[model samples]
Target: MTDLRVGIGSLKLKNPVMTASGTAGYGAELAEFFDPSLLGALVMKGISLEPWQGNPPPRITETPCGMINSIGLQNVGLEMFLREKLPFARQWDVPVIANILGTSADEYVRLAAELDGAGVEGIELNVSCPNIKKGGISFGRDMAVFARLVGAVRKTVKSAALIVKLTPDAPVAEFARAAEESGADAVSLINSIPAMAIDVNTRRPLVKNVIGGLSGPAVKPIAVRMVYQASRAVRVPVIGMGGITEGRDAVEFMLAGAHAVAVGTAIFSDPMAPLKILDGIRAYMENHGIKRVSAITGSVRT
Candidate 1:
């Protein structure tokens, strides 16, 4: 029999496929396509203490092999999430990981503590959000600030598994190490890269924000590289994401040192992408004569 389980600290998932936070839209959104319980885990969209209206329209724009979005992390505030969103997710048997974002350390700590107390299986800190108290520098860019915030959340979070989703702007190895040292149970990497597109006809930026994060097939190679770097740097599991569109893409990530992979952009084009990718992983394992999916992690040739 094939074994597909993967563990991140004390949290052991039935498989390794997860929905990228922002794209999954609070977990319940995917229930229409399939049972969310079938997934290894459901990582819901980014959540904030107060409602984030997100950026203005023209938020999403397409590029050659991907799209750019300055969606501005729009989400329903914490109040509604606990009142409505989480109860629906609890109906499913799969692990639910809350992706929390904040403008300062206090907000993150409060969110993490609340989610942990709520009995969610996991808490992922989306450090890509800027530190409003520090002149808007993204928490992931500055190691000192980043580690301090992660540590504070760790102290506040007592039960749920903690993960740090890293930004692509810095050296992933150093950042991953810092998260692991500060008590992260796992680390997810390759948050969208900063990119922009221009319209020659109107001379307007393709995305309303002027600059948006690029994601999809175009970022796969970079995601792979960073996944390998981070995995090699830490003992904790690494969840890789970027441009994963198929099962083969997930295999590429697993071989590159990712213990798990998340599907994001493809979800926009195909709501069933996550299950398809998960199926692809099983096929690859059988073809390779591999019975344990965990063996695929960090098996890349140096």
Candidate 2:
């Protein structure tokens, strides 16, 4: 059997397939479709100190190969997450990662403290949320702000692993370096680029939010390049996601130096995509006479 296990900092995953934040909701929501335990890990939606109602009107729009979203990070706050979501997730067999966001450093610190004892395997800091008009770009655009925010949260969370999610809009190498220097255990990259669509009839913005994060196939190449750049900049492991639809797509990310891969838009297309891709990866590894998934990470040559 192929050894699919890989490490994200000190945390080891059974395989390199994880559900991206927002797409999988909390772990419990996907349980109805398939066995949650079969997944390598499940990343929850971006949670805040308080519940958010999210943006107004149309939040998601379908594009040619992908989709644009302005969900606005709508989620139950940390308190309710701990009281309700985390407890339910604890019953699942796979590792659970909480994707968190806050308007300020203190809020991030406070949320981290609350989830520190919530039995999650790790915490993914949502530093790249472009939906919120106020603080969405605050932490992601500036290296100093990113470092300070991560540093504060690092001090607060004692147990859970910390993974900083980065935006593709910034200088990926510099931003990733800042995250590592500030005490991030690992980093996930390419959290959708800012994009907009026009309504031909109305001659107005397609989405009510005016701007949305573009994801899916259109963003895959960008995600791959950013992941490659980030992997070279930091020693911390990198988790990659963009428009992965099949096993080969996942392999491309792995070869680009992503320690693991997350499936975002593909999940909407195929609810069983993760399992299928996981199986395909194993078959490919065995066919190539490879024994472990680590053998492919950063193995791409010029």
TM-score of each: 0.99, 0.96
Clashes within 3 Å, all models in order: 1, 0
**Which pairs clash inside model 1?**
216-243
Model 2 TM-score on a 0 to 1 scale: 0.96
lDDT of 1 by residue, 179-231 (tens): 99999999998899999999999999999899999999999999999998899
Q: Residue 113 deviation, candidate 2, in Å? A: 1.0
lDDT of each: 0.94, 0.88
- Per-residue lDDT of model 2, residues 1-302, tens digit only: 78889888767799999999999888766787889888889889889988999998788898889888988889988888988888888777888899988877788888888787766789999886432435456588877778988999999888888999998878999999999999999999879788999889998787789999899998898899999999999999999999998999999998999999999888888888889889888988988999999899999996
Candidate 2 at 66: error in angstroms?
Answer: 1.0
